[model samples]
Target: MEPTTTTPPEPRSRRGRRPHGKVRRRLAGALALGIGLLSVGALYSVVEPAPQTAVAQAADAATIAKGQDLYNNACITCHGANLQGVQDRGPSLVGVGDAAVYFQVSSGRMPLARQEAQAMRKPPTQTFDPHTQEGADNLAALGAFVQANGGGPQLPAATGEALRGDDPARGGELFRLNCASCHNFTGRGGALSSGKFAPSLDPANEDQIYAAMLTGPQNMPKFSDAQLSPQEKKDIIAYIKSVSDGNNDVGGSGLGGIGPTSEGVIAFVVGLAAIVGFAMWLGAKQ
Candidate 1:
């Protein structure tokens, strides 16, 4: 039939042929590659997590250990080796927090001068003899040690402007109840027993006030956040600011805020002396 062989299907050139075997191999390879990639990704997801560097963990451990040692040696007698505190000697320090410790110890009020009606701030009875170093290292060691044992509020690493409250009314109320007992309603600061006094608030900055409250330096009661609540403390600070602004109408100097007793004494002495001098002059002239 005109070359009836039909050209034998033109010998099916390799280019036109499907090459089924090669196609199957490529498909299998692609599937395997995808599975391998997925398996690797899954394994990585399981193993990797948020990182906590080994150095940080080690430092924290060291700090806790040092704190435990210090508490045992310096604070254990009255506070108890476990920080449960002796029956009447000291209060339990479980959650009192680091702020309390810093305030009392740094201010030289702790390691108490002696057991009395209150613990007073005085020169540190026992100085931190860091036989090894000075400055930050010593402070870090002490701070770490106290922090480990626990007793009071913690000073924030960054006390921003947020530490200074915006609300003065609340600050005033807080000041009256918690601070005014010793500081006076006017924030003039008042006498405690002995030579110790509350001192004037005129010079105190936000940090000093916060530290004073947290530490309760020298015979001052500890005001943990649990006790005073941060909001109340802010209000008290506002009140102190108001009083310190000098709202008095008198044209003369206010001798701090010790009040009329001293003022009256000065007036009597000065005025009476002037009157007597005038009388003597009149008699001499006659």
Candidate 2:
């Protein structure tokens, strides 16, 4: 063969010598990185945190399991096996958290004596008789169960000074808007559609009020932190304390804090007395 040596293949350039597979992989990796960044940006835009969701850490798994068992046995009959509640017997317990359960059971307002207009608070009609330390343990267990199920607001380990806000006036405005219709501007509470009534805030302590707001105990609507900020809640509490602490213009009795009812009664009585006195004076003149 004429020189018999095929001309040496021209030396490939370093850039052009790169393997096709390696090039494809590098391009794929860059594309994946760009897609990930876009996805993160989209997620950041959509997700927002609620204000009052800063609850204490979750309860232990054992406590939750025990609570589930107790719920199944004692509460299932009325609250439903799944905690969805019975049609005519009990309202749904799905979102009602440990705070609600504690308030209802510990206060003896639950395990209702009868299905009535309202389940008023009363002495524990049914006592628990656990063989060992089960009574106290059971209560704790049940609380854990309701808590784990996930629904209502959770109580914090430390309510702290943060629970008390500085703006009572703002609280009053908020109260008028969100709570006045049912609770009355004075926190004296009012009747609802049926025999059920919003109980007076006078008897409710800070924790109790917070719990009620969080859990919506009975027929009340749930107020998640997303709906009302914690600072706002504190302000509401301050307003309640200010109004309930006996600083009103009522002649010392406070008259249950219902302005119209008390004022109407007073005006009616005074007006009637004045009319009678005028009549007597006219008669004397005659």
Candidate 3:
């Protein structure tokens, strides 16, 4: 009875209980925040689109494998086991890229049958023909193989008429400035020093021309995108098509389409022959 009286009804507010309540509230708030974050993360995982990066990587790996197989079978002899090239047999294909491969293989200038001053264009083997599905696949595989070894120029996605540009006049100007010296004013092609010669544009298709520009093939100077933009390249293709397809030409005859030199020669020959014939007729009359 004396102890209870002295204790005197310990202060109505219990400090211990207050602190415990505050701690419980803080723990509840923290648990609620954690649950909210976890729920948001779970929702995002279900809604987000599955990434295709891994699938793309797998496909790329398969393509590279097929290319490597083709290279080992056909190209390894000249290009070396690692594309470093053989001593005098073939140049290194390391940095040449798919554009060069397409040009050389598709044009039949590669798989060289014989060693010569310059590789001549011939009919491509059935395996490399772009017209057939099998051939096209094989060609792509081979190009991919070379491309994987070292990166370089690539061919345009378009083909044939699609590659032609809308502005032929501007293309003509560019052709004259850069290509006229070797290909002639009409894209007729001319002789160069050594055994190398500028190939006639007469036989070149859109793909070949585009590949040549990208790769520079042999003696031709490489016109990178920096030098000639893709649009400019297309324009050049248009000009070549216009001239070579005979859609655009001067007055008459075109004099073999070799430009003024052939025209001048023909003019002189015809003029001299006419003069001589008239003189002979006059002599006969006398």
Candidate 4:
């Protein structure tokens, strides 16, 4: 049998060097797991979002919700469900800024009574008054919503008297040069190119005035903070108040606040005239 004696029966490990089925299974499983992990890593990389973008999205969503609530409650009637505005009703508020909203709502010009050449200044609705806490919050939320959707001018944090300055004389000069064209030198609203006209500053508060300058509602041009410093804006407010009723007096005794000297002179002249008139009357009776 030619030494064929089973060839000494090949060793178990040396017979064709065959690997165990368990080893093949393990290798296949490991390869599958690695492939799956690589796929998962690539997916995560593609889906990951920036931290700031996520936060901003969340904030915008919340603001939009709140604004939708407010708009549904008050603005939907004329501004449409999506703020597209209605024909002959209200204009679209897409790009209008928080400043415009603050100016109109704070001054009670919105929720218009009827479609007219302009929205006249009146008493602010109970919900939109900037002076009140609730109204202020609502205004901010509403503004955020509008901004998130349309992107318009933004009002500064330092509103109202925070922007007021100390020099009324300078403010007066600035007003005469810049503001008098549209808003009369007296601050009473004036006519405009279109039906839209300048709303009177008499009804506007300090914050409202600042917002108006910043946003330039209607035909008014936007006035950046760079052009008019905070101090200058405050000074202009002071000048307006000095001329328009002042804080103490909505209608003071001073005729157009011609200063104390003029008032005193007028008073003296009137008193002197009265005394002379009495003397003349007595002489006539005699």
Candidate 3 ranges beyond 4 A from true positions: 1-51, 260-265, 276-286
Cα lDDT of model 1 by residue, 215-245, tens digit: 6766678777899777666666666666687
Backbone-clash count (model 4): 2
Candidate number with the higher lDDT (3 or 4): 3
Tens-digit per-residue lDDT, 1-286, candidate 4: 5765455765567444445666788899999999999999999878887687889988878877897789788988888887788988888988877778778877777878777777777887778777789888788787777777677777777765666678888998999889888787767766787677766677677888888888887677888779987678788988887677655333446455443355678889999999999999999999
Which candidate number would show the highest TM-score if scored against the true structure? 3
Question: Roughly what TM-score does model 3 have, to 2 decimal places?
Answer: 0.83
Best by lDDT: 3
Compute the lDDT of residue 57 as modeled in candidate 2: 31
Sort every candidate by lDDT, greatest first. 3, 4, 2, 1
**CA-lDDT, candidates in order:** 0.67, 0.75, 0.88, 0.78
Better of 1 and 4 by lDDT: 4
Task: Measure candidate 1: CA RMSD.
Answer: 8.7
Where does model 2 exceed 4 Å of error? Answer: 1-59, 123-140, 160-162, 247-253, 260-268, 284-286
Report the lDDT tens digits of candidate 2 across residue range 1-286. 5677678887878777578769899999999999999999889667744332333233366677878877887789988877888988888877777778766775567788888887786554233322236564676678777777756657655453456679988998988889889999889888998788987887666666776777776678878889888778889988888888888545556666885368678779999999999999999999
**In candidate 3, what are the lDDT values of residues 8-86, reduced to their tens digit?**
6767578768989999999999999999999999998888655676687877788889889888888899989999999
Give the residue spans of candidate 1 off by over 4 A. Answer: 1-52, 125-152, 159-178, 191-208, 214-254, 259-286
